[model samples]
Target: MTVVAADAAVSQVDAAAAAASTRPRCSTEDMLQLLQDYDCWVFDLDGTIWRGNEVIEGVLEALELLRKLGKKVLFMTNNSMKSRGSYLDKCLQVGLPAHVDDIYCSSYSAAAYLDSIGFDRSKKAYVVGERGIMQELAAVGIESFGGPDDNEKRASFSSEMLHDTQVGAVVCGVDPNLSYYKVQYASMCLLLNPGCLFIATNTDARGHFTPNLEWAGAGATVGAIKGVVERDPIVTGKPSPFLMQDIAAKHNVQPAKSIMVGDRLDTDILWGLNTGMATLLVMTGVTDEQLLVAQRGSSNGVKPHFVMDSFGDLRRVAQQALQQQK
Candidate 1:
């Protein structure tokens, strides 16, 4: 699992590309060994587990096997469109054995981050996202407005619309109902209201909502706000080390004894690397082999320790391991 440093004479990009070419593929034996070695398994949801509404093939069985084997299994995602409860419902609907406690989405993380920062409970938050952000904020006793409610407001922008000077923070996420009004309101809050914090659940540029297409993600909305406000928002999701540090503290997760299974190198794999966990890249979500290979030269030396076609492939390894044990 160690990446040997390349020759100093080689260019940095060339050395990284060379190192990537030698990245390990998770063979059946390696998977089995991983099962034996790691006590905890952290999985990314969008790509590594399911795509859109469909569960990735055999992933349910693989998760069941992990639970049966007494491994700690957790699901993490940057998709801020849904709260952890909603995510748990989706998991149950798709026959994935998941508990509410095992789910960690950015919606929940955003709320947690606010609470950690001692955000004024009396102040209101303007949300340019969806019900998920609202739900999470409410759960933490923080008041919020301007989510789906503003979807109906199509009026031209004006200064009078920026009425809520009490808005202490503007939280942006993957807003399917994004509108000019929302962007203007969010921007005005940050610019007009003194010390009004700008927060982003995540900055993922694109998301794999369907098998054939990529859709604009939270980053698009964040970018729109940034354009108007000209200020960087605090990112609370993946690769930030905020949520990971919280997870480690609350869940007793020993990074060295855990493996992070994810699809995107920038977020999932990089987050694991930052937190000192082993990383496995799966190809069922946004990242494909071609993209993976292309990123080698541009990844700034970041590479996953192992690669696999799909997480469901682990079911086969688990089945084989169970048979051997029997």
Candidate 2:
């Protein structure tokens, strides 16, 4: 789908900052300078700009500033729990701005992966995740396995089904009702046939879903299955170079000029760094200051070229780079 940045993104910062101030530091002028060069930006939302119910301070201002500089902004998140429409509402609720074409979530990536790989959903495959994940499956023509046409049962997911020829693959993610029985069924299928593929939505460790933080993300569960099945599953999420390719294609932007921004080392930052794209690690979520600081010793320069306390300062780097050219 086409993703665009929101107009509210700029104005939404101050109020959010007042509500959340226990954050890092930034320089306004520096951010303004950085904005001069880069026209496109890919942002990670959760920790970099907001945490749960509260939006990060100055995030809206940062976004607005980017708009002022004529930069193209997009939100790229690895969490595939919520659908694009839900995310549209999410931006409105939090005061962030981006067009529907500017939002690229892991679900989009997963859907694109299925599309590129030519996954035929005519067969049966048990689902254990959120609606966003299922939506991606449907985009690829992957329907539920329990339909009358397939003669599959809703609870057909089982060790027996895994061993049976009818079962094709196992797709897992964050489902509150996930149970040992469900896992047993998924594992049974993978274990039954080493050729079956396993796919996961993301690898986020933890998210402030609500009143309290929750267990890390879809990674551990997929990892556990990999350990048991002794077969590697194909990861259909961020940092795979595939997502960037899809985004670039849709936006018609040059990957060489675009930059990816976020607060996590594993998902947001590394996704860009590993794929030969410029990345910025905003100290708003998952990886803290200490960890980001300690992580700087990489001799391979595999680390991000720049790090900022928040998205608010992104413009500074760009502005400064532009000045040097003058």
Q: Report the number of clashing residue pairs per model.
A: 0, 34
TM-score of 2: 0.78
After TM-score superposition, the amount by which residue 27's alpha carbon in candidate 1 deviates from its true location, in angstroms, is 1.4
Consecutive 10-residue window with the lowest summed lDDT within model 2 = 1-10
TM-score of each: 0.90, 0.78
Angstrom error of the Cα, residue 33, model 1: value is 1.9
**Model 1 regions lying over 4 Å from their true place:** 1-20, 155-160, 299-301
| lDDT score, candidate 2, position 6 | 22
Q: Considering only N, C-alpha and C atoms within 3 Å, which residue pairs clash in candidate 1?
A: none
Tens-digit lDDT track of model 2 for 220-291? 566666667777666666656677777777888876677788867777777887666677777556654445
C-alpha RMSD by candidate, in order: 6.3, 8.0
